[model samples]
Target: MALPEVSDPQVLAFAAELAKNDGLVESEVLATLEEASVQQSILDAIARPAESKAWKDYRPIFISDRRIDDGVVFYGQHRELIDRIAGEFGVPAEIIVAIIGVETNYGRNIGRYRVLDALYTLAFHYPPRSPYFRGELRQLFLLGNDRLAYPIDQLKGSYAGAMGLGQFMPTSIATWARDYDGDGRIDLWNSYPDIVASIANYFVEHGWERDAPVTVRAVRDATARPVERTTLEPLLSVQQLEAWGYAPTAPVDAERAATLLTLEGPETEDWIIFRNFYVISRYNRSPLYSMAVWQLSQAIARGAAGDRP
Candidate 1:
């Protein structure tokens, strides 16, 4: 077969960077890029992320009876491993299950796109995030055969190149992925121990607080004024928010630093989110995503405890 044309300056520069950083031949990197197929659907998917939806709409997608029930089952099936990893990592097992449940429905539908094609399409065609995707593409090459259980060309994942049950990106796999099975290989796809432990480790690395509250519904007083939120980090104190007329419906330490979130539910919903909530946001950086994971974890916990059907 004739080699695909590779004259794009960005692609050439990326190949050079990969070769320089990893000591791989530039021609080989260019050959790999040339073989990658650019899918327009990947570009389209990136533009319309589910996080764009309102809380009312987004909640139904991941918080349905089916999802909650399945999460309970998944948690039950992996209870031993989950509990062990949770205790070792100081992260809750329910939160770990919820992360997998939200990311890939407990590995049923991890993704459809070939990771190479997805990263290549976004790296070369999507100008808005080209630099980021390009960096991922570089990391994909760096991951090599040892770290990845599957060959690079054969790996499949989300449109943004997030792999396995947790939908972890290249950087996450490099930094937070664990070999819990002790097989000296990190397979996020088939190994439940690796998957569960990797997720828990990620939470721990991002400062997950053991036994701390993630978020709580706030009863907004009629006289409350909207507080401006510039960042997701928990910056304001619970006392400060209470003074501003947003009191947690549930009890929390008054001195705890928190941030207020206003979500568009049936009616506008206010939440006093804590440091643990911020840790969940580190996984996806969307309040809606973090909230969905939190709510799903709660529902799953309830179901597992025989509180819900």
Candidate 2:
């Protein structure tokens, strides 16, 4: 039923039935849903910044020389963990570290949102993606039951309701997370090993390629037009890209296998993307986010090179 239709006795009855099916206490579920307050926050977040502005605001938060350097040094510090995860899941250490650096700055800022509040607000009241949040809410409840951790008082992440070290959605925690440290708990909230392992698992499950490059910068010309941003699957070759006047900065082993991406930069700037670029986007859907990860990863990679005095 729709929001208004949720008042229907039939809808209430169905919710009641669902509660029973999910092994939830019916009264408790009703109380929780009734007291749930997601509308205000959803409205606030929606009515606030535009995506571009949000990107701009978030831009300065990432993509700094210092951050890049930190990433590089951090990668070295965790080289063993990264290597282990890479060997286990086939995800590169640089990308995984980049992801961790991007999501929480190496477990620095997880979030302040209440998991229940965020999920509930978006689930029942945020109409655009209510069904998705609703599913996440269900997942949250199931995750809470795993006995390793409970969602009730857990601190969640930003406006969209992602959680903990990796900023994983509740469903992602249940589905893709792992207990990598042999502690018998998938503690993405704090454990570095679990966080690293889970992130690697996410990339692997999503098809990260160890042999692939993340992205490349293209020299833009006045005649440049829109490059096709296709599905994540590989399609174009490096030679084909050169034909389009965009080439990889480094030598690519594959003759012609990459995706093209165009991004807006400071002062009418732009960039060309590659298959590895799409992999970063898999973690965060935004192109700006992927760029940040790539830039930060590059920074981190440099720091790991022992350039620091």
Candidate 3:
């Protein structure tokens, strides 16, 4: 195919920077960028992310019976691999499976957008987060063939440029993707060991506490004061929240640092979320996404156990 028209100064500057800082060929970088077409559909997709939906709407998208059942079957098939990685990384195996299930439906539909086009469109066209996507584009170029088994131009992933079964962004893959099968290169697409371990490694890197509770339903008393959540970090202690009249329905250490989240579910739902819940947010930065993953993980575990009969 003919090279795409490349007149954008930002794209030109990016090519130059890659050539100077990363020692890549400027002409080759330019050619690669030129080959990437700006995808309006990708721009549209990013504009309406699933995270924009309400909790009640978002939960069913990922937490369906089919997804839970598929996760159970996937776990059974990869039990040895998942368990070994989970033990090694101190992250629950069901959480790992749930992440994959939510991201790509057990690797069945990772994404359709060509990674090059997706990143290019976002980096150049999407103004709100252009800098971030530009940085990802830079990382994509930096991920040499050695680090990524696939050819850069041919790779396919989500509109956000997250690749693989786990839907990892370019920066995340660079930082946490592993060669678990002990092959010379990291392959998140076809390698089961690498995909599972990389996700577990990401959770461990983000401070997932072993055997710690993710979240619990909370009850707000009649006199409870509304607490605005300004951040996802577990800022208030459980005791402090209780003093404010929001208490966990289940027992937990009074002194443990936690955060209160109120979601619009079938009925308004309140949750006292712990540090592990914040770690999950590190993966997607959306409370709805984190909650779906956590709930899906629980459902998957239960389904897997019940499938034994």
Candidate 4:
């Protein structure tokens, strides 16, 4: 296919800046950007992310019988490696698998849209987050310079440009991805060890505490009014939530910070999510996603114990 003209002044300016900053050949940089086209479907997908769905609908998509079963099998096959990685990183093995499961279904589906097209379309056309996408576009060029495992135009990822098994963005791939196999390269596509270490490293870097509690069954008093659900980070301490008559079913430190989450449904389930839960949310910044990861981790554990149907 012939390259399309990137006539947008912002895009042309960015291309020139990237060429200057990265020491990339200007013509090649423009040629690559010209090869990228605005994908309307990518725009459509971005408009309604999985995070926009209700917990009832979103839960079924990731916590299905097949996914839970696959997670059980995945954990079994990678037990030695996962365990070692977990021990080394101080993150739970189930959490690691659950993160991978929630992200890509054990690397079975890592999206299909060309990463370059996705980033270009978003960086120039998506107004709400154009600045963020612009940075990712720069990171993409940096990653492609002898760092990307595959050909630059050949890498496929989510519509928003998250790549590989853990759905890492270009910046994450550059800053945190490791050569876990010691093969002189970091390839997230087929390198399980690299993927494992990368995911664990991401969590560790973002403050995943060793053996820390993630979430707990929350009980609320009638005095408690539903707080805002938009907060993904831990904004309230356990002590504060306790004073508000929302306490965890399990005992935890009063000093530990936590967040309140209500799974929107007919009945409306509530949870007292801890700091670790907030750390998981750092991966995607959605309470629904973090909750699903925690729930799926429990389900996989149940299946491993022959308790899941």
- RMSD (Å) per prediction: 1.7, 4.2, 2.1, 2.4
Residue-pair clashes per candidate = 0, 9, 0, 0
Candidate 3, residue 268: Cα displacement in angstroms equals 0.7
Give the CA lDDT, 0 to 100, for residue 167 in model 1. 89
**TM-scores, all models, native as reference:** 0.97, 0.83, 0.96, 0.93
- Candidate 4 lDDT over 85-124, as tens digits, reads 9999998888889988999999888999999999999999
User: lDDT at 209 for candidate 1?
Assistant: 89
TM-score, candidate 3, is: 0.96
**lDDT on C-alpha atoms for all candidate structures:** 0.91, 0.69, 0.91, 0.87
- As a TM-score, model 2 comes out at 0.83
On a 0 to 100 scale, what is the lDDT of residue 161 in model 4? 96
Clashing pairs in 3: none
On a 0 to 100 scale, what is the lDDT of residue 1 in model 2? 24
Ranking by TM-score: 1, 3, 4, 2
Q: After superposition, how far is residue 173 of candidate 2 from its true place, in Å?
A: 1.3
3 or 4, which is superior by TM-score?
3
Question: What are the per-residue Cα lDDT tens digits for candidate 3 across 1-309?
Answer: 333467889998998888899998888788888889998889888878899999989999999888988999999999999999999998999999999999999999999999999999999998999999999999998986567878899899998899999999999998988889998878999999999999999988889899899999999999999998988899998999999999899999999999899999899999999999999999999999999999999999988889523
Q: Assess candidate 4 and give its lDDT.
A: 0.87
| Candidate with maximal TM-score | 1
Q: For residue 246, what is the lDDT in candidate 4? A: 86
Window of ten residues with lowest summed lDDT in model 3: 1-10
Q: Give stretches of model 4 more than 4 Å off.
A: 1-6, 225-230
lDDT of 2: 0.69
